[model samples]
Target: MAHEPAVIAALDVARPLVVDLGYGARPDTTVEMAGRLRRVAPDLEMVGLEIDPARVVDPRDGVRFAVGGFEMAGLRPRVVRAFNVLRQYDETEVDAAWSRLRAALSPGGVIVEGTCDEIGRRCTWVLLDVAGPVSLTLCWAPEHSERPSDLAERLPKALIHRNVPGEKIHDLLTLADQCWDIAAPLAPYGPRVRWRHAQDLLRERGVDCVVTRRRMSDNVLTVPWEAVAP
Candidate 1:
């Protein structure tokens, strides 16, 4: 959620519209998103899209609803948040869905696709542009996490089943776990402190860790797609 501002800024649209793809039966998620986004972009609009016709709700202030899937209702959204939607499809279908959704993006748009635990403590998502996926972001509550690699269970579907010994994602998580162990001494201060040290270790080992000072304390890490691509 911290990166939402960056997602909005990248839109470059005066009255940007963000689509909550497959926003389930409940309209609460879409409504909350609009309220939060309006804090940054007052003119922002939110549209909730669901495959189930019954899930569509009446249009409300700065928010609307439509029945559609990957090929959305002919609306070129500046940002698409497809949380946990792809998990229901086979991994092989991901590319096709991404292509279809990417085609629906307006200029400078992006698709945030991924999954999170029930309580929303941990999350992993890919940031996709017209060219394809550019980065993978992992976020969690540092104090509640066991290790950096523990996020593996929350990885997006595209990479979740590919966490084998020789896979790139596996390699990254293995190294991250090792670094977390080595930084155990810093744990007394708090997990965030230890995580910062772990990140430094990752950088030292040539892992492409992208950290921003403003969000560093958020316990989030963004790495280039190539760094952990399967």
Candidate 2:
């Protein structure tokens, strides 16, 4: 749910929405995403693209499938959600993959890429406008930890291996944790309340953050990539 809203939102403005570079083996998740997006953007047409031709399924309805990588999906879509496919890829190759995905967008479209823990409880993703990476989104269940720093454990592929000292991501997450500590008294009010208040403080203090009440309700927070990168 890290970006279910954003995805639905994008589909509202663009047509022939599709998800490229999905995981190789699972059709179930693709099916789920197709239905969810269709519900919000009734005119949407989703195509699940995969590198393995055989893994791609020519599904029965609303959703379609193609055998290809980000490089040549033979499609132009409004949105593409590529999750967990790059954790195994070297960090240096990320930009190229993104370039290819962005190439498939129709004018003002997007490529939402990121990583997530299985079962979808904790996750992080990046939103790539046709131009390039614009924002990084973090999603998790507040029930996992009373402190906001717990999100650091679910870093997306780009920041996952960069959580060491001297890295920007490390600083952002650590500082967030420190702020969470100072706001601990709010914990008595509840994680959601404390999180909301803490996020508000960060914004007032000039943190470049913009989040919806919906995202907050979904237990997510986001920062620009420059704010938290190695």
Candidate 3:
């Protein structure tokens, strides 16, 4: 499940992990998020902010349900994971949302915004900091491999619309696919090896890079914002 403890372990923890901009359609994910955080960071508190106040039920210790937007509810947190929360917004509005969320972060905070297929066969998200965009990560298991750019079809609201010609996101995605193609021989080494080789290739080719032993195991290749930014 997206909000499970194992999944939450991959996510960084903060004092108050807030799931800003949840849905009226379901609060189940928020509930799971709280449970998972308590497992990973025992002292962590979670707050779910829903613009639709009706969705927020009775609150308890370590978890507060509030009515707020993607801009944040005047709470500074270390981690904010907003999944499928911005799928409907216009691209132009994405920046404002990011600005508001980043502004509300506790200095070193990170915001992960993305969408996953109903079953999570394929998922992608962007990581941002106070300095602005950082990287776009497309996580997919290739049992159903199409072109890597198929994910371009599912870019976040900010980038989905920007996947056209002359876009940075477009260029970086293409580069990712190209890296995959060039690193095909490494596939014999295992997907993880091939991926690491591919990422190394990116850095060698001077794509601003960020890769760690921990991140690599997670199947994430975090590149510079300019490489895949909108």
**Candidate with maximal lDDT:** 1
Q: Write the per-residue lDDT of candidate 1 for residues 1-230, one digit (tens) a residue.
A: 52454585755568888999988868887888888777767787789999999889899776999998999799998888998898888989989999999999988888899998876788899999989998898888876688778789889889999888999999988998898899999988887888888889989999898755553545877888998888
What's the CA error at residue 217 for candidate 1, in Å?
A: 6.0
Per-residue error (Å), model 2, residue 141 = 0.7
* Span of ten consecutive residues with least summed lDDT in model 1: 2-11
Q: Give residue 93's lDDT in candidate 2 (0 to 100).
A: 86
Expressed as tens digits, the lDDT of each residue in 45-93 for candidate 3 is 6777888767787775556678888667777877777878888788778
What is the Cα-based lDDT of residue 44 in candidate 1? Answer: 79
TM-score of 1: 0.93
Ten consecutive residues with minimal summed lDDT in candidate 3?
1-10
Q: What 10-residue stretch in candidate 2 is worst by lDDT?
A: 1-10
TM-score of each: 0.93, 0.88, 0.77
Candidate that scores best on TM-score: 1
Which residue pairs of candidate 2 clash?
A: none
After superposition, candidate 3 runs with Cα above 4 Å error: 1-14, 35-40, 58-62, 214-218
